[model samples]
Target: MKLKTLVGTFALAALPASMSFAWADAAPEMTDAERAQAKQIYFERCAGCHGVLRKGATGKNLEPHWTKTLQDGNKVEGGTLKLGTNRLERIIAYGTDGGMVNYDDILSEKEINLMARYIQQTPDAPPEFSLKDMRDSWKLIVPKDKRPTRQMNKINLQNVFAVTLRDAGKLALIDGDTHKIWKVLDTGYAVHISRLSASGRYVYTVGRDGLTTIIDMWFEEPTTVASVRLGSDARSVDVSKFKGYEDKYLIGGTYWPPQYSIMDGETLEPIKIVSTRGQTVDGEYHPEPRVASIVASMTKPEWVVNVKETGQILLVDYTDLKNLKTTTIESAKFLHDGGWDGSKRYFMVAANASNKVAAVDTKTGKLAALVDTAKIPHPGRGANFIHPQYGPVWATGHLGDAVVSLISTPSEEAKYAKYKGNNWKVVQELKMPGAGNLFVKTHPKSTHFWADAPMNPEREVAESVYVFDMGDLDKAPVQLNVAKDSGLPETTAVRRAVQPEYNLAGDEVWISLWGGKTDQSAIVIYDDKTLKLKKVITDPAVVTPTGKFNVFNTMHDVY
Candidate 1:
């Protein structure tokens, strides 16, 4: 039976008539008077859809979504509610659009803040499906259309790598085992950051544009979809692995290097905003503005987070999706991008400011380890975040001198290292044959096909794809220049950040490349085992207005 059908079948039998809600994390402490006022405010305005209990009458239960992720790559479910500062601000400024309304003009920001505080202090649960029960329902159904038809290979030293890409405003997916290209499924929103569930059953993504979408791996159609308006633009998003709280979610802020916006995952309700004071030095003054205005200034940058100003990270409980916290770290600098390891034990981000990768222990809420990537490159304004496989991390530096660093766990460390130890050294730094530092990739399935130049477009630097020799880092990563006979001529130019991903079967690597002159985008499939070019699929739908071309910035995630 198909996965979706199986899930539907089980859902029909396993799901109880009603579920009891529970908060997973403790709420941030507040005063009694303030708490009372907050409760009154919540019922006055928010109770229409969200129950007076802040649970939910017409919407989702906020209590069950509060759980978060753990270091073991598992989820910690059930805790008390905490109304983090950011969570309060967002909820007041932007009311939800679909089931909720904009509150910027209706309620004073102060009222919203107090109400959020009260809600956080007060814990409540509504009826819903338990994780175990939900999983059972999914198990008896047919999987989504994107699941692989062929048998998957046993992941080994040669086969693990994460494929990075963008989806249609949705979460991207990478095969959990091989890190190869899995199908890129739409999460229901323009994806800024994509995250997977602890069990790899769901993929989550949100955008600065105030859109959030979640995709169910077991369902053929969308499992659950919701969005919230932050009023101020958003910066980044992180999904917790905590059990019971898998439904919980949170987003970051931005505006002059904006702060993060925290929200409710299950109901798509805005909660609060985390802000960083802008510098007033040099007699220059800066005031925070709406996110939409700030985003209009950039020419082509995708997302921006000023870790220098705000050393804050957002956390949420997956169970109730009600509790949230934004912690600030002092004396920290140059934080780079991050991703969760396979075990879900931890999620590490590049602290480019400190010249080291800071690994945050999800369970203890501590800075567990800092692996130095000293020789690689200096931290800069832009850094790309990629999760090759669940555990191993991949990052590309803009200031780093032509190199890609790969950090692996105990099991895959040796294969990631060029020489002896795979501790904190540059595993591989392939000099960019091009000018910009931007880089993206798809999964590595077969070694059959390679990147090469086209004969038609233009003869610049032999415009082609460079294949790297994973075994050697110091020597130049091998570049495979496709011959004129290989599909499009060797001279055709492709865009930047075009990563190829391997399918679940580990046979094909799918790549979306931009055609320089044709102003068109082409999806190239490389035969992994043979390292040869296979087929090029062109899309006329993606056309740029000015350049008469359509281009894909990053490889969207595989579902």
Candidate 2:
């Protein structure tokens, strides 16, 4: 049977029970406050997959439909369908093979139990957010007229890296040239991704809590000038990169409310809100088709907005916001994160749950190709480089498979017309030591490819990063012990290595040693030439740094 059919059947079987099951009698009950806390936790942690409405897309359906009590008062139990509280708790604690990370290390036992119970109850529909709500919550702390006309500091804006200190609810601005932390500014909880304006003057950060902050780098202190709340939960944010609309507008994608919000780029005054709830490419009406990623087209005055559940890529014309025009291209389901190809004309996004990478030709506004890939391809702005044999290829690391898939992309350049036959094909699959990888990175000037397996539950794999030589694709990756190389004392907890980012010159690569909230986390730097550890940045304030984006690379979409 197809996965979608299986999912539908599973969801239908889990409908809420009219009478309480026998397991509820033995299960520990929660107070009103605890229940509320559990709901919040679910929104922050589980909503991205299971969805705000508990209708599964990338993740399994978590509604109470699976835990309904039978006429005999027994909980639902059948082949591969176990809805008991104990089974639910174990799944939450240990995670499944479907790319869900183990929460045992991230959440407490009590919280896990609460979440297990929370899913058994009927799902709640979050309050809808409108343009008025966004406008009311918008705050312009510093007007554009009051902002500096010229660069106020000597810091090289291109070399500055915006690092997300996830658990700390802060963004650490680090000088990539000097490898030093410049400033740590407060932001929303677990800022998803930091985006740079077209001119590279402003840094925009949207958090999981739906808070978006616009930071002006021209300020002497590099502080946030404007802020607004998109909704309750958001993941992606991007500014207009087209010539006419350079930094004129900003767009944010929210997981909850299933909507996207557009605001003034300078002041963050929300102008419009569009709901993504509609029929998916599969011809099914999905209620929770969250906007996953939005990338501005460099060749056209448009934004490629990827709707996660619907598997529809909407090329939204930003030329006229009042009367917006969109061209929809159907692809695979669960479109998450992606990046531009080497030519920047083709935008490739990972439809992770479907195990496919959908490449769209932004210049033509059409679906370029849909290439099959390994399971759960979670590429955070996937790596792009010229393959030795193939003309150009994009790299994506997988979470459910032990391989890094390199796909050949078509190029319009006249110099390389012979390799056009390999376009939109999986040319190679580099074997990694293990699965569970979130990011794969390569700089234009670097000959090495870096990938981190932080999502892997195994300590050895999670604590290490693999580096592959671009000169030879057949050789195995050199495993670097990132946690041990951090020069910090070993702990029982796994300090996962993640997010390899390059400096402006691509001479050095930085990896984050993500430890527990209370433990000391460090950003370990390595010399790209020698593949040797250079420096380990650890401080009290650098807590749980996950993703570090270089200003020059991010602004230009180098990767």
Local lDDT at 267 for model 2:
95
- True-structure RMSD, every candidate: 20.9, 4.3
Give the per-residue Cα lDDT of candidate 1 at 310. Answer: 31
TM-score of each: 0.47, 0.93
Q: Top TM-score: which candidate number?
A: 2
* lDDT score for candidate 1 against the true structure: 0.37
Error of 1 at 403 (Å): 2.2
